[model samples]
Target chain A: MSLDIDAVKNIAHLARIDVSEKDLETYTKDLSNILDMVDQMNAVDVTGVEPLSNALDATQRLRADVVTETNKREALQANAPATEDGVFLVPRVIE
Target chain B: MYSNWETVIGLEIHAQLSTNSKLFSGSSIAYGAEPNTQANEVDLALPGTLPVLNKEVMNLAARLGIALNATINKRSVFERKNYFYPDLPKGYQTSQLELPIVEHGELFISVNGEEKRIGVTRAHLEEDAGKSIHGAAEGCTGIDLNRAGTPLLEIVSEPELSSAAEAVAYMKKLHSLVQYIGICDGNMQEGSFRCDANVSVRPKGQEELGTRAEIKNINSFRFVEKAINYEIERQIDLIEDGGEVVQETRLYDAEKNETRSMRSKEEANDYRYFPCPDLLPVVIDDSFIDAVRGDMPELPDAKKARFVSDFGLSDEDAAQLTNSRPMADYFEAVVADGVEAKMAANWCNGELSAWLNKEEKDVAESPVSAAMLAGMCKRIADNTISNKIAKEVFEGMWNGEGDADAVIDAKGLKQITDTGAIEAMIDEIIANNAGQVEQYRAGKEKVFGFFVGQVMKATQGKANPAQVNQILKQKLAG
Candidate 1:
């Protein structure tokens, strides 16, 4: 499937990205090329092939029915952009 | 708008599975954690970082699938959904695109006593992205990675909902089932569970679907219902005005009660969906499925049945009690502590529930113990404590002072069951309310109630009601 110029523009705008006219023409051609490769995938018969949802085919593992975590406050709050004691700090809004 | 335009609605709900860690990382999924503090290098997508799937999340997804009567696929794979956003620390999101863990399940949800079979298209496991903090600065946007990489089970449904009520019903049904399974905590206020709706309208008997818009990130159920209704009307008006309904993702302004277009609808939101090179395909074997099935607690349906048959509760009462696992568990524990099932269910659904709500406390944090509640009921049954005293004791128990026995004793709330004591009160009442006594003797039998009220007031509401009646009747007849 070849990419359409309108399709490229729509996708970029939906993604909240500004694409220049020169870049748009280039992407139009590049996306068409990529879609053509994807079109080849459509040719292969996948009637029986299952679509995968995860990497492992193993059965789901079970955790012991117990709480493994309790406290890690300092560690958890270590990366805040701003901190007051143990809590995160955001910009004050009200007067 | 003609009457024949059938509304086709379906929902894709993202429920954050109640796992301790992220789906593919070791970061804590604890709510209210400091921003970016719980995140590790993997969550931050630092160089050479890799994702390792949390096994408990898989079990949770399967447990939900089993409850929904879905087919658990033995094999599933993760793919990269490529998108660039500040909240998405990873350049692309790892999601289940092809083989979802559960598929082709059906849920029978009842809406106002009308039952409908809604199909579960698929339920897949994925990781949540961090939240973007917008509208804060004049031109700056910040990202909070506290919720980054939390495990999410994306449950998608078929377009079987024909009305907004059905859509909301489906959501409610899913919400209850997930909570019942103990997979998703179902805390809508805390953003643990959320819903996105895909809605479209078409001419009657049209072979192809009409243009549909995806309404994203509606956390509350009422908003979901209203947003769908508003979007449907918007589409109809657009079509009537000879305007094409643009396919796009939109956000609902709940305050405004309207949906505004956020972005134009795309044929696909291309994350350039590709197989993630980092992770391997997940293989689910029978043993894993069996273990998950074994780990399954008594679900809502089974609990409801037991409540009806064993506890002799009505179907509606049973349904209400078992709608939440914690409430149902509390009811059973109260019964186990020797309260009559009917009485146990009553207090649990009534005063106990009211106390929890009034104090904004969870049942797990309830100060009243099952044994204490049962003992309180026993006091009421044994004529040891008056109903009024029982309520007083209940409050004491709610405050963690003590259970029925201790509270009743400490407050001297025991019933005045002593015949001598009650007889004395009755004599005083008969002497004082001479007119009422005369009226009773003159065949105004209803005046007996007035005499009883006087006796109760004389005793400070502590006299046993049955004993008061017996003594009053004997004296009045004499």
Candidate 2:
């Protein structure tokens, strides 16, 4: 699939990024190249191989269901841009 | 305008696990906490933090799968679904994309005495996002991360439900199943369990499915049915007007009882998914699955069957009693206390259910204990109190007057079984009600009931009704 400037703009908008007219062409080319390389991997014919979902063929390590962490709200939220009444504040999300 | 249309629906339920901690993090999973207080560094996705799979979550998921007769995948992987939302601090949700933990499960639900088997496509584990509290601040939103990392098992069902009632029945059955297995608290108000319904309509006998609109976050069973009905009518109306149904997400307005479009499909988030790098694939051995199966509780279906065969309860009564584990347990406890199974079933489902409904209480929080109910049933069996007087005694028990005997004694509600006293009362009634006695002797059999009623009134409703009937028949014949 080929990428166009409009598609790139839409992708940018979906990613919550602002793309200008001048930057749109550049982003389209870059994203197209990335998609082309992924297309190259798709073109290789593997008749009988099972697809792998993870890099390593290992099972997940399970942890006991216990609450070992205590409340660190003060330290954790220290770097937040804004907070009020123990909640993080952001520009209003209507939905 | 909609006579030719057939409504089709499917449901996706999200049940929050009742584990003590968050799915991957060590943060407490308690609800209604101070904002962000239950969230730890790991839950916030801070740098250098990683997620570890909680063992209890897997166990609970397997338990649910087994209860539904679903195939438990021995191996499953977690993938990151990338999306942008303020509540999602990680910029992605750790969920199962390809291989869910459970799949192809089947559950049977009955609507109007007709049973339908709804197929479960899959159930996968995922982390819940935080809450975006809109209008909490002026021109801003407050975010509570306390629920951000809680575990949720998203159960997807096949689109085989034909009507809103069937969808509701399926949802209720599934809700009770999860609660039966002790995996979820099933509290809709607190959002412990929630449903998203996918609805569409097509011309009758049409094989091709119509585009479906998903109504999201319907927290209660009643709303689920209402939302689907509204969506179905809307689709049928649109189609009849020569308009097409656009696939989209809708929100049900509970107050208005209508579904409104939330977002169209074209503008929906892509949710680019990839296997999560931080967590490894979850692999379960035979022993783990066995352990889950071994510890599984008697599910609803099995309990219903047992209630039927063992207790000789009617099918409807058995089904109703086994709707929840607590009700089934209460019934069993009453029967185990030596009350006849049929009587226990009747009182438990009849009087107890009615009282519970009237008082707006759950069977679990019933004021009358199972033993106390059993005691009352025993009094009825032994002719200590008539059924009518037993109701009065029950009212006293509910008001905390005491157990059956105490209530019976305190309220003078015991049935008088003495033959001589009843005979004297019958004689007095025969002497006083000469006209009625003559009417009764002259082929007016109905007047006997009047004599019985009079005798019962004289005894203040304490006469054993069967004994009164026999003596009144014998004395009047003489």
Candidate 3:
């Protein structure tokens, strides 16, 4: 179940990370160690053991079906790396 | 080459819970604030700040499970999903790993008139990370902390759907259920509900499932259906050409209406998921579950059925009424004020909704109140006002002029329903339109309509339609 070194390199590349050569070897070893732990999980007899999904058994609570947020000011602003006066800010390229 | 192929589709939907606070902090869960304004020390994942589970978030997740007809897990624990992202202030995202809030549920979706039950894998609670803004000023990236730490319920569905239509149906059903349960607002435009699908294609009747790829963060039903269809075709082509589908996470490029590879899919262990040490296990008793269920409102399907049986509404009308709770309440309120169910439904779905949409308002903010619309309907029912006059009154009310009765009175829109008055007008029309009267008597019986119109015009358009028709017909015959 160990992830090959090349597969680890492919994963790092796909994730858009610049893993240096030395780090790639380290990651390959670390990831293999992790997958070995998962392999240990395959030995357990879970043929009929129900998979656990939730820790709490309670029902989901409902809120008053009202428009809590009429203004989307903060939600819209949260993603903008730059903003001013309730508007998204960007660099003036032409100026 | 007509060969057999089967497509398997599963969904992971992320819905923002309609809670007022963050899942792990007391900061307001308000959307659209200045960057980092809503963030607290905990939301920022500052040192020494331990995560606290919001009781309301857990309850909301449980309610979604119930609405999906899933089994509520008595014990669900939160685990830290280790990852690195600027948006995720917490270097590790605290999410459900071992136990989720819901399990063993089924979503019954009606696809092309055939009902199919999709398995509910799990629904769990987690906090939304902050957003990253790339390609900002001078090719630099910017990070916004405003949406950081919002509560979201990740609902995962099994790969039960086979076609694009079924996928859309399943998405819509989940959207409607969350809205009905009052857990999530189900606003797709506001990013309240988002869907991602894992799709794979295999040869027909193959017992082994194909390697599925996950499409991430598609915000609309149209995008989901398109993404699934595109992925299915892409996978089929790859298989036909002897290429194997890779297990990876793909991003849906909405602008291009296509999916692009984002990353190779990370296995559960890749994030180093372990039980969060800072947070305690979430505990729930039977009383909590019962209380949450007790607070549950009538779901959409049941409410739609009620609208049909009680209000004598058409299938379309019932569907529209139960689409949103506020709209349904407004419709019922008008009916409660003694308006005919059909008339109330018409006004709500037509004129009222039109006005609301035009003003970007909801039914709760409708200018024409239920009682006012009911009064207008009553006037027409009692023959005190013509349908045309009622429309005029409705317009006046929409302008915030007055109530229906007051508007009608101010506009002098009362109908002339008296038979004698109508008969007098009809006599005048007969005398004035002598040529038409002669033609009516000479076997052209359609001239009776002309006489009725003349009577209406002579009465200044106040003549009761039934009375005017009856008097004109009787006098024309004589």
> Which candidate ranks first by TM-score, i.e. highest?
2
In model 1, the runs with Cα more than 4 Å from the true position are A1-95, B1-6, B135-138, B201-211, B232-245, B263-268
Q: Over the stretch A38-95, how does candidate 1's per-residue lDDT look in tens digits? A: 8898899889886554456643333332233334546655665754443334554221
Task: List, residue by residue over B123-239, the lDDT tens digit for candidate 2.
Answer: 999999999999887999999999999999999999989999999999999899999999999989899999999999999999999999989999888898899989999998888
Q: RMSD of candidate 3 to the true fold?
A: 6.1
Rank by DockQ, descending? Answer: 2, 1, 3
Instruction: Give one digit per residue, the lDDT tens place, for model 2 in A1-95.
Output: 37988888878877789888988888888889999999999999988998787788777899999999888899988999989989999999756
Residue range B312-350, candidate 1, lDDT tens digits: 999988988887788888888888877889988888888
Ranking by TM-score: 2, 1, 3
- C-alpha TM-scores of all predictions: 0.84, 0.97, 0.80
Which CAPRI level is candidate 3?
A: incorrect
| Candidate 2: docking tier | high
Give the winner by TM-score: 1 or 3.
Answer: 1
Model 1 chain B poorest 10 in a row by lDDT: B134-143
lDDT of 3 by residue, B299-332 (tens): 8889999999988999889988777788888889
**lDDT of the structure predicted as candidate 1:** 0.81
Report, for every candidate in turn, its global Cα lDDT versus the true structure. Answer: 0.81, 0.91, 0.79
Docking class of 1: incorrect
